[model samples]
Target chain A: MNALSTTVGPPAMSRRGPVSTGPNIPSLVGSEPQQRGMGIARSRLVFVVILFCAAFFVMAARTVELSLKKAEPMQVTKQHVTVPPVQFTRADILDRNGEVLATNLGTSSLYAYPARIRDPEEAARKLVSVLPNLSEGHLIQKLSASKGYIRLQQRLSPRQKWAVNALGIPAFEFAPDEERIYPHGRLAVHALGAVNYKNEGISGAERYFERRLSDAASTNQALRLSIDSRVQYALADELESAMRVFQAIGAAGVVMDVNTGEVIAMVSLPDFDPNTTRGVSGNQRFNRVTQGVYELGSVFKTFTLAAALDDGVVDFSDGYDASLPMKVGGYTIRDDHPKGRYLTVPEIYAYSSNIGTARMALDLGTEQQQRYLSDFGLLRAPDIELVEVGAPLFPARWRKTSTVTISYGHGISVSPLALVTGIASMVNGGRLLPATLIRNSEGWRQGKRVIAPDTSRKIRQLMRMVVTKGTGGRADAVGYRVGGKTGTAEKASNGGYDRKALISSFVGVYPMDDPQYVVFALLDEPKGTKATYGFSSGGWVAAPVVKNVILRTAPLLGVAPKTEDEGLYKNVALRIEE
Target chain B: MRKIVTISAAIAAIMSGVMVLLLNIAVQEQASLNRTLAKQIHDDREAIRILSAEWNYLTTPRTLEDRSGQFLALMPLRAKQIVNTPATIPLRPRGQDVDTKGASSVVLSSADKPRKVKKNQRKGTAL
Candidate 1:
């Protein structure tokens, strides 16, 4: 209505002419003939209209093309159609620091459909080149057996897989299967335990937590153990070296958090790899820390003295006449570290005097001794996570002689774990915390108070004196104030204790003013070595290992190395030894 | 003229039906594509698990000890080599690598532990 409807002449000029007459007139006048002008204007109008129509057509076509586009056939690939759902049959076992200890790993096993396989001899010949372990004739015999399918190899290296694939045999195929694997093989074998070929947990933590680990719902999450692999490695490394150096039959060590009772590391040397556990000797698999029960020698004196002090039957200043061997019920009691004089309580403990300790036990009496030892968790098997825990053997009768002998860690047997757990109690403010393998085990809060705090302090002092003034001097790792006892026990043989073979052990607590960790190392029948001055005693063979373990694991546990009098952990100033 | 109008309407109806069918096909294709991507993600996760195992195997203590070549003298860190606290590290004397007065040596023994600041230590670091 405004312009297009009102104008029949060229719309462009008319639209412009109505608005600006001056400019339009000059252009109209200076232009060519009116007829030529009309013709050109009409042609231009048709061309512009056609151009608009063409552009509209193009847009319309594009709209249709986009809206009704044919879909490419669904590119459903064979792999997409056949992807297997990921299911971890078992939960991963991880160290406290979240390092992978044991997990299931899928390995490829090459197999051949014998019926479809053409030229079996050729295939075997080619396969043998890549896998030299499989003899060509044996492989051919198996391949040509007319069986449904025969295994060429159970485990194929990546290179072997590629090499076999390069040969392009259609009949040969790989079947994927998973096997339980321990990346740190043999490093934590005793603690982690073994698994069967069917992926069933057989021993150790594996057997201990089989249900939780194998359940589908819980398998997605990993089981974090109280164990620190670094600590485990160090303890194993040191313990193995000690065993080798001492020419020992076996060795065991445990490093535990004194307050939490979380076993940081448990090592038993002459260990086997959990990965390939076929033909492993039963003796090699025996977990000495948790399963093997030994008398554990004078390490028990700490318990006896702790018990006596706890019961208020003995004081630190009290003295015992250790100059003479005490005869109790036809049993003669003597001291390996014989100080033939009146020995104070500290002297009796530091010197590991069987006579003095026996006198203390006799003062407490048999009933009192048994009660304390039972309370200290020495009279029963350690309720640790492993299924292979040892049932402690002590005198069922609890005779007066038994009390005297058990006072110095004889006439009874306990696992290394039990001894360490008991020591953890004696040092950790008298709370007998439950030993645990699971990370962040909250069972310590429910710890039973086995002794008075004052008594625990006194026990720690005695233990400290053992290292500072007595047999455990070799266990003192400088800057970290170690306090411990050395126990060199005679292995029991026939009707009596063997005079030759011995179990030498040292159990240490660090930063004695405030004990945080307990390190225990024991060598079973470690023979005399030149380096140890031919003394196969705990002070000589096992104490150095305790020192090595402490030195290596202190920083890892964030226990700042301090001088004996450095910070809150001041020197354990015992009363002057008279 | 009536025939032309009817024919144009018929063409329009057929095109609309075809577009709807094509759109439906497109939706199906996209859904399948989504399934494919999901499958790919699952496969990637499995691959990651395998690769992580391999990585852990390679970085095991025994492996690292063996792989520690001549150029790298890999020895277990001793406790004495560790510095206890930052305060004992002795304020680099506000100077460059050049010799500076009142500057303490970099090496501090365990005995020099001025454990004044003990923060961010492993109280079961990041449960």
Candidate 2:
């Protein structure tokens, strides 16, 4: 404790006194302390030099220790840490570009302890001051009751919560709660789905991905779907506008990546807001693209021709007579606008000759038609990540009659999602990819081979022919090399077809020279319009919708435009005149 | 003389021990500061989460389209009008003097364009 134990004396004292009490060094050396000022100065100088050398050695040793030691990351000790609970109950749903589609927004639920309230009248009065919606007389009765805990309000806005806090009612308690909110409001309602009072996913994607959203590992990171909000909005806007113009009962549209089968956008009209599901009609809640199967009239012809061409039953050069109504058993098939003579394969398609397509189907045979439809994924509901998918309705027996009617899209019904998925297969180099709503961040999906690559090229050429000089001329977007078909299927009634109620649809692929996207638009029971000259066909109603969507989304998709004069597809020569 | 040598070395040893103690105190202070900084980072991430939801709300396609439709008379972009890069459009003829008129017109055409886009445009990769 005395001068003997000091490691280093204070700076002022070390100048004149011994720096350390290390076993009396001077006494051990047997030296006398009889030196003058210069002797003391020289000794001090020696002390300074040794001090610097000692510091240098210490720093060198520490450096060696650091370099030699295995580099360990500095760990913020988590062994005994009491972590806070997860703030939100459900994981957020984002679009492909990371735009939040659905999220659990936080709110405070106001509750009160009836036993703790000193003045029932004053407490109820104070509570009503911030929350004017609560009945004052009712609150007075509930607050005065002997019940232990009473709920005053289920949800309160941040401003209301702050104001209620300012009231400073000791009996009141605020429980942190969250509600599923879709701030985009009806934008992708059919895709994201809705949640119930307990925040349980009830329908749509919300119901489908319940476990993933609640899973602790994935609750922090958002669930990203393959929907692009911009593309989705453009598609929906065009379809809705067409539906309004045509006075259709309902409308549905779908857009997908041809090669990947990633559904970029899907819209079903009369869609309800996911935020508020109460008082919504079943029709409004229905997802027509995935959940409502309808006989999509002439769009089915593309499949028949693809099947016939791929199976070598017919080439692009071959065709059938459309002058007479071809009869398959008892059913007679006639073209909507007959050419009154022999129709070429391209003419049959461009003019939408049902007889020609039915004849092609007969050549392909019933078994081959069924196999092709199955391979195209049109026989079953699409394999999308939603629980609301509708099973396709088809004839149980594959007869010649069934084949002929189905050839022109009459004998069976399939969801719009299935039709678009099938069209994607026909043009995506003949690979039939299972449609997906989830984003495949990994890589391109490997699809099953449905048709030969050469067949796909020919189909693309034929579809371009339809847009350039056929029924789908309305959908021929300039510089896009648009190619598609128009379908106007009379709705099936009690043992007969109702010609008045038509399911007019157009399924198309753009930049046909190198197809990337397939767009399908359908209007249900569209009454003939004055502008359309009382014609409610797919070409009049849905083809223009598809064209608008392509024009709007092409810039967003960054597809470089080519001048119309650019003769890029000279290899595929199609003679429209013949 | 040996007594003085012994004393100087001992003094150096004692001084280094005191310096080591001072260094230990400084490290302790720094570690506590790091803990505070880490807490701030955690809180900031949470804030960003809430803010992102609000940001998306204010800028959803429907909202942005409606607001822009009201405020700006800008027409929708067309495929022909878009050029992938500036290099694709030559600034001017190679050796020609800077055409002030042409340069100003180019700037005027693209006037009021956003200087920066913080929004993540989801240009999805091919499957």
Candidate 3:
């Protein structure tokens, strides 16, 4: 054992001596390697933890941005974008009874981002197929443009938009747009007017009420109109029927509430559809009631007789010699059917005697006549919603000759609107209310005084007399108590009155005792037909139209039929000498 | 010393548990807010759509005519119906109240002007 120990100790001592050449070298080296490995592993674990935290924070920020911001998509290309400085327009236009007259609708307009389109031909083909209305040449021209973006079409229907979208053409896109639609085809086209592609009102009541319709301040309120759809349709129907029956060049009619001054209905024939007014002719587009001025022949006699009675120039007992033809200004004014005897004032109106009317006007004198006519709203343009209003044509200088010719409705011209409104005031208790296309509210009664109540009553009596015993007899509705005046003026040709061209018209008021409504019908250049034995008199052509309209609309308006004992006609009936 | 260590460990565990609960609640609240905002945006879009549709419906010519006929009792207007109130007519009475009568009676008596029968005019002629 000693010998073995001595041998191992010597080797261990030699090894220790070599290792101790440096201080604790073997032990230090072993501990240093382990420490280095542990440090690396710890640093790696820390890095992993930091990465997880960073990932969590990133996810939280992404979620917040998506949920909280609701940001609009950023535009990727340079394009013209008009950012509205304020919120869009107000509520829609509705009729008096809450029917929609005008409204805004969402539509899609097709645009092309040329930079994004991969296949121009394919996109063009797809778009053309869906929008067949576009010409192939136009489509090709549009697609071939070198511009970054181009508007392909405006106001595409939803179906068309969807069809275009389904093609998956990357460059083809839809832009949001607004469009206006007039649902009722051609019924009230002239009254309602039309809008452009941008939903802006261009004409009619729509244009007149455009500001109210588009005002953001009026967002919740709808613009109401005084027009009644029912009455408008009835008038249109009657006028169209009249046109067809008479084969007249054109026709027009109006129905107005006498008491309220509300325009119940206004119909103009040969009217264009507001829905598509692209190809409407100027003649068809003319609003005859408000824009076309005509020499409304005998209808003017109502005003003439009313003036005479109100001015104390004539009374029921006043008589005029209707036997002679009055020649004034180289024009012989004679009644179509001369009585060949003295006619009472009431009889003159009843028979629409031109000679008597001229005599009455001569007695009133030109200044008085012009003043009365101006007071009746005849010397100016008709008050209406449209910008297109016709002014009454009167002689620049008033003279005795002019007065005589104008007395029998031969020298002046005025729009049908002016005539109706004037007659409305005469029969509606003498309050000259401005014609309004918008619906009346509680505050709409503001109007000017045109005449005395007594004068109105007298005029009403005369009007009733004409209906019951004169030329307006055909205009009488059995229980409606219709009173009116008929005008059959020869249309002016090249500086002369055309014998063949006649403007036949009838203006009537119902229940003359308390006139509630005034209706007027006019036929332009109406030809003489077999129905009238080749005669186009106002009574033969225009009066019956008013009668039919009154009869048909009376029940609809809730105006009950009157009994014979109602005593409504007592004051206006002519006194027959026993 | 051991008791102190055990108490410290328990406190740390409780704190961690509370933090986890708070985090869970925050996540739930964020989800609810997201849903509410989404719903509001959807509703606004829908309102815009409805208003647009109504505008189109109102402006159509056919709809306007129908409404006019149904509500206003209006007839087709003519040029003759419009008059210059001051021009051709005489001064009417002012401040006179209208009397109420049946519609039919009003129609009959309103047209007081007697129509001149043309020498060859026929009776009961349709307009």
Candidate 4:
């Protein structure tokens, strides 16, 4: 490069007429130096322009390629930008007052990748040190397995998770998970039901509202139930105490709003806690209030008498002969404790006489009896927001014996919920509203009237008489005007009645003149007690429960109490036969 | 002139490179901060869920009832004890005006004793 520069430098100097060969251009003529400088500047400019053109050529070619590629669909950039996956949560269950009943608890589940673990024994030992419940030998064996992934534990509490994290064992990872928790324990287990490990609702309102509960958009909002937690506690406490006192195998009870058919509280005892449903017996999980079908005995007499009056077969002023056991077909119907004389219709109902009820049913015939029972929804499973409801058992081909026995609640079996709802229809101005578990401002459907308003009024009078003068006197909450019927049906077993094992139940309505609420309680196979004088009748075993329930819950339901001396229900009180 | 052009071009190249580096660093920082914020929000939501569940478990009816039984002296209100209206409250007798400043001053005689609750008091009665 130096030799070429020397040759070019002299030629350029000669062309510009330079006299001296000095290295410095300042010592030469001004015109000669200026011409030589111009030539050098032009050459440098051409070199820069060439370099710039090369860069432009490359940029332009790239631009052309990009533009041409736009026309080809296969050239589309399918960049798979991954995002963190969001998990769906189950909605919370709340009482009417916005108190939490059931909720989805977030937890961290631990899993192990055996193939990624450095030392199975060391990892298992460290893990067991933090989690004492985990078996060291089992964990070691599990961690040493060749499986790519293995679940080590599930539903770890936050503290437990922290302890496990502190261990810092390799190959152990925590996966976020959830568990369904029933906060109330066994208080409303039968109502809230339970969820499986997969977070799917298995029974009760949980199963009924599964779709709405798991919806991602609505999961945060709590699903409000009509149940008032305080009233539910009261009902459950009274029922459980009664069950204990009576030595019953199990018990069921319900408190329903007569006007709306909203079940304020429903309890089926011998219930298992939803939190630990493992190894729970079938009997413990049975929701007797809505699932078990029993012939509710004299509770059905309310309907028989109402049907008679509604069909114009009898009047409140009419009298029926209870002088002897009335024979119907091959069966003879007799009162539990007969009056031994003719009694008025109100008297017959107050005493809950099977003879009077069967006679009335004979007068109405089987078709009319079937129609009334069907209208009361006694012939079908109750349409409620629960999956455990039982379809009623009744004779498909109605006959004379069927009518007679059904009148006294022996020839048919229905759930306790069905009986309570039927009584609600008879007393709530005759409107048979569909019972519901959801709270509604407008209550349930008004429904068609099963009986005339006048008949309902007369039936209410008869019901109040039962509390005032007869078997249900034990259920008379002082100022609440507690009114209902005592049903002591011998449970049918082995194709025959088990007389010793009775289902003692009472369907009590408060403030009979107003009829705002209906409370029904039933005890299965309650043994005779010393306090009960060795009698396990409905009045002895179940009526006191109703009395206490009304006393405790009426105030919670906002039913005003009248002084007994106020003569509020005096007009409806029945005169007892001496 | 060539020297002036060459110096200006070098300065421009260095400036562009520094600007690109600074912008790239800023964008990367923003993205990292966004990821951190998203994780924080997710954790906060999970914490809230856990706390609410714990609150529910602590306030269950059974637990509350147990607490009440141990600590509270209040009993469930009875139907007869509930007064629907102010008029239903028996007025204080005239002779008991010694300390009428407070409604609690009145003392009841044996005759004013509460009537027994027949429904709850009766035991061993024939059914």
- Give Cα-based local distance difference scores for all models: 0.84, 0.83, 0.76, 0.84
After superposing candidate 3 on the true structure, give the runs of residues whose Cα lies further than 4 Å from its correct spot. A1-91, A443-446, A564-568, A575-578, B1-127
Q: Each model's DockQ?
A: 0.21, 0.25, 0.07, 0.27
lDDT of 3 at A4: 31
Task: Tell me how many residue pairs clash in candidate 2.
Answer: 1
lDDT tens digits, residue span A45-79, model 3: 67987998799799889989889987878764543
Worst 10 residues of 3 chain A by lDDT: A79-88
- Which 10 consecutive residues of model 1 chain A have the lowest summed lDDT? A567-576
Give one digit per residue, the lDDT tens place, for model 4 in B1-127: 8667778978988998999999999978977887777777777776676677678778876687789889999776666567677766665432232443335633533243235325565432222
Q: Model 2: residues >4 Å from true position, as ranges?
A: A1-87, A118-122, A125-129, A132-141, A564-575, B1-36, B83-104, B107-127
Report the poorest 10 consecutive residues by lDDT, candidate 2 chain A: A1-10
Cα displacement (Å) at residue A175, model 2: 1.5
lDDT of 4 by residue, A1-578 (tens): 23434434644445444545565555543467766986886699679879989998998899899888856556324432233333448888988877778988778899988998879899988998888989999988898888788889999988999988888776788998888887778877888889888889988888999999999889867899988887888889998999988889999999999889888899999988888878999998899999999999999999999899999998866878999998878777889978899977887888888888888898998899998999999999998999999999998888899999999999899999999999999998899988889987775467778999988887887888888788988998988878899999998889889989999999999888788899999999999889889999999989999999888778878888875542544544534464
Model 1: interface root-mean-square deviation in Å: 3.5
For each candidate, give its TM-score against the true structure.
0.79, 0.79, 0.73, 0.78
